[model samples]
Target chain A: MAKYLLLKHYRGAPAAVNDVPMDQWTPEEISAHVQYMNDFAARLEGTGEFVDAQALAPEGRWVRYDGEGRPPVTDGPFAETKDLIAGWMVIDVDSYERAVELAGELSAAPGAGGKPIHEWLEVRPFLTAPPTITE
Target chain B: MDEALLRSLTPSVLGILVRRGADFAAAEDAVQDALVEAVRVWPADPPRDPKGWLVTVAWRRFLDATRADAARRRREDLVDEEPAPGPAPAVDDTLQLYFLCAHPSLTPSSAVALTLRAVGGLTTRQIAQAYLVPEATMAQRISRAKRTVSGVRFDQPGDVATVLRVLYLVFNEGYSGDVDLAAEAIRLTRQLAAAIDHPEVAGLLALMLLHHARRATRTAPDGSLVPLAEQDRGRWDTASIAEGVEILQAALARDRLGEFQAQAAIAALHADAPTAEETDWVQIVEWYDELVRLTDSPVVRLNRAVAVGEADGPRAGLAALAALDDSLPRHAAVAAYLHERDGDLATAARLYAEAARKAPNLAERDHLTRQAARLNARRCR
Candidate 1:
């Protein structure tokens, strides 16, 4: 099976309000989006297909190793990565085409406007290892 | 065949498929398919030679699919005859598989998942449970990893360190999934050490044994983490300890010291101690110093600080901690411990809570939270 990384984050995963910003969405629409996502995650969890899901904090900093004399310093994660990852899921499936299919489903997870966020999801495949008896 | 038998024969069957010119990724997929079919067919008519049967069926399935696929037509043409009929591939194939799985390009988590599925014959769900992730996520990771490595020619040799790390993680997991991950890791590592002359391979085995010997006592009677100091020394496996120590001593005598060997030495010291008070904190610190020289990992330095604390005093440890990066995980927790030791309960409690909030895994978070709660209770009392 081909694997795909389903990137998750406020901007990465489906956020219900792709057309309108989350702040612009009505309160009822926001609640509906939240309910939709919760139900979607639960449904995926019920299936064996759900590999992993996480939500990371928005606060992040860039770092570099410093020279012997100079101390290391922290820089903000401010390099215009609008779709920064808060979390991700790695799923193993039958084919790359199938991975795309699943990603589409995940992308459809609700956003703030009570419609499919269809947010930008980064799909990455895992590198394979040695053979198994089953393969 | 039973699950135990399935696991035992998995590597051999995988080796056979690889020998028959199935690339590593394709062979793994075919073998998994055969195992599933076996689970379905075996209960009714169990094969006398399970390995032979699995290799035969999986190979056929591989051929059928390869022939059907437009992209793999060139590789499929290399298979002179579709149905593979042969004795198992040499032990060398098995060793090669280990190297392939541990390729440096793959992440440690992906490597572990691939090895467990291919070498250990574990199900995707089983692997997911052990790591506390959903099966789909793990399955995707494994598949993506396979596709990435599919381009790497099987004939080319790869870095052994990657393989060692994967095997090390497997051993360290201590049997969370359907398969006994620790045992599978040992079996695979033993296979690796036999094929390669690397001293660290021996060191890894020794490390596994040293830590594994006390695995029986790692958990408390209530199933929580029992710190090494609180462990019942009597429950330790003396035989495993002896074997580990012997291997470690042999490796050390060679004077080709490596990180694994240094870590094993530290574990060996812990095993040698009859009581927490009698622990050779000074020697352990010395080993940690060697480790820092070999690998400048911030985590190693963090640990060394603890050893420094034990060898000298909590104040010394705190000073060392202050020199470290503030972003390292468990930094706050270690600070809390050192602070508590220095009679700074308020600071310790606050740091402990902060550490608990930052904890990655649930068990660790719970344990840290408990530590904070216990301190709060004591303060009130």
Candidate 2:
């Protein structure tokens, strides 16, 4: 069965975690964490099972594209909202257990504080519509 | 060219294809292909034991296709692939096929397709026409479903819930043309109930019988929806209602209250009423409460609100509707119905129009739109 990721914050949510000063961590540690996440994603990509994945920007702004010229918009750091989502990935995995294992690995990616925040992510199954039968 | 003989042998042909290592999906397709050929050729020379003749023909077609598929590791490749047994395989062939068709990984649509084709003994064209979808799209869906579950071990006995869900989908298709898919679903579910003695199975059969018992009265002579309060109770099938009540009582006595049992309870209450005014809405609401606890589905919640409205009043029903997510598919429709009951005709008309826009089928769209028109006409009058 295919699986989905409900990427979200772990400790007191994203805003609380983002409040930690980034300057305190060694630059090399940050680079290592980034590289680790990229490599893990790359490995997943090797299998045809890696359907989709992407990290969403921490900040989001609402805009009205309905206007003619440069649609009206709003400002950013994007206030910490309750039940806000970062982003999600849809992956084709053989079982629920395997999806959990992959999510755990992603959660372990080191943050700017040089410690794995291991954000608590909720996993949900995607209910697909019935297939259209062709003649 | 004997139509009666061909109909009789359809299940046997299906059995032979399944035994010859074709999965429920492939077996269904191959048997359908053979049956079509039989219809075209058999009238001229009806064979003795026509079922045996069909079995031989369909098995060959199944074998031919299995070998031709390059991507799939042919079942023929399996060293121990069992040869077709003589006419009338000792094993319960139909049950085995039913288990495979209702395999867990397959989506409800694919499972329904597999079961109808394999168990209902239908042609792909019949299924395609029945659902009003392009045959190609359905074929691909079924193929993809079959491929996805290819690795799933076929020998293992399957879950009953999956099987029940498949049959329920069949029943819900609702008769559009001459097919009478609802009747077909009842037939198939009956077969399934007989095959397995699950309380829920019996409960589902009762539920279908009770609902079908009122299907005629659900629509008025003008083909508009006849709300339950206005339905002709005399038109309801007394025989079916009795059978449903008897079966439901038996199921309830078991003390195993599954989702079907809860649904059947509500149906039984409805069946007991001689007139809508006399309906045991309190008992119906209690069953809905049980149904919600068992399966916290938005649809069930919507239904509960209806019963609550019936038992208490419209305002209470609207209050229940308010707490649920507005995004649910039937939320607007249910809200409209409640508003109409509460005498807010303008709001009811607006909501009904909105609901008609979202109705899944054209029939539902026309029905809801007509409701809006009638209310608007009443206001002008």
Candidate 3:
């Protein structure tokens, strides 16, 4: 089975169709959205396609080595410019079509007024190890 | 407790239970229970005959579970005739188990998990840890695989190639968590080689050994990748290399060459060399040609280009690479190496950076990044 990553962006992605931020949404609508996302993951797990899903903190920094003994340089969280990933879900499915279908369903998660957000979720395929028969 | 001994006996014990009329899933569960018991009990009290002990215990567990289930009344007739518990017949059904675990119906990942659990005798948790998946996910994968293969009769002859492919996948997983999957793969392949007399099986075993011999030197103390040419040959396992070479020679003498045998021949040639500079790239290229003929896979052709580069010159290698699809995995990396060899430092540096971004894994990415950084630094100097 091939593994695919469905990435949710905190900042970098294009605006969703609904466009309303979570804080602006009604509490009931937020709960519904959360429930839908959870149900989606649970459904995938039941079908044995789910690998892992995780949420990332918005804050991040870029660090680089200054020298052998130096403490290293740290850049900002880059709140507005840099691509800040909100979270991701990893799924192992039988085909690219299945991956795409699931990603489409996930993108349909409800937003304000219990309507589909139609968010632009980035779908990336993981590069796998070369098969032994290759050698 | 002797974990290896227990694992070695696991398939045979499970096979006995299944042959004695227990269904595959139940038999496997019972065998796992027996193994768990062995781990818990055998530490204080060792069994006189481990396999016999396992068979008896696993069979009893299977019967108990069957009787406990109301829906399993259909299996009562099969369980009624329990043979006397004693030394298991020398009829090794492990090969059948291998085939079953690698059944065509299951996905490659499912097959791998099933083979590790049922054939490799690894616990679900262990397999989970090795695969970096949740134990529940791995458990479900294994159960699903077992369910998929449950309907297949045990007597049906299986494709050896499929079994080999599963083992090869396991081997290529390398090491993670507490399990060294490569060593386990070698052990399984060795077991398969003992069970069957196929030259390809021997070829696979030899190939694993040859690769494993150089494993220690493949990485540096800082956990960075070491290219083959830069590895310390003095530290390579000569014993393993010797054994691998011997096995490859015997397989080659048979003249019935398969893809594994051809690949092993290539590995053997690399092992035979005194140094990377002295490596018989011409012979390696010939083996790659044979591999291209056998598999016709673009990956093989990509690898062949690397060998061509070594055997002839950088220009020749680049010429060979020009014929293949550039989208192939490691294509950029190979192109970078050849360009670097051809003294096109600027092109090599750019390619190295591009390859680093496209690398499949962290280690390879880091290695390619370093290569790019090295070239960039050299150009600046």
TM-scores for candidates 1 onward, in order: 0.71, 0.65, 0.90
lDDT of each: 0.77, 0.71, 0.88
lDDT of 2 by residue, B1-381 (tens): 654356445655676665566675577677887888888877787677677667777877776777666337634464236474476675555565677778877766667766776677776667756755445544655566667666766557878888887777777643465567777877777777776788999988998888888888876677666666787889899999999889889989999989987887887787788877899999888888898899988889988888898889999999998989988876778889899999999999999999888775555677788888988999889
Give Cα distance to truth, residue B85, candidate 1, Å. 3.0
lDDT of 3 at B110: 90
Cα displacement (angstroms), candidate 3, residue A87, comes to 2.5
Off-target runs (Cα >4 Å) in candidate 3 are: A1-4, A17-32, A56-84, A92-98, A111-116, A125-135, B71-79
Candidate 1's residue-wise lDDT over B177-292, tens digit each? 55666767777777777778888989999988887788788766665666778889999999999999998898899999999999999999999999988999999999999999
Tens digits of per-residue lDDT for model 3 on B180-277?
89899999999888888899999999989998898888878987788888889999999999999999889989998999999889888877888999
Q: Model 2, stretches more than 4 Å misplaced?
A: A1-135, B1-16, B20-29, B40-50, B60-87, B343-350, B373-381
* lDDT sort, best first: 3, 1, 2
Interface RMSD values for all candidates: 12.2, 11.1, 3.3
Each model's DockQ score: 0.08, 0.02, 0.36
After best superposition, candidate 2 residue B356: deviation in angstroms?
Answer: 3.9
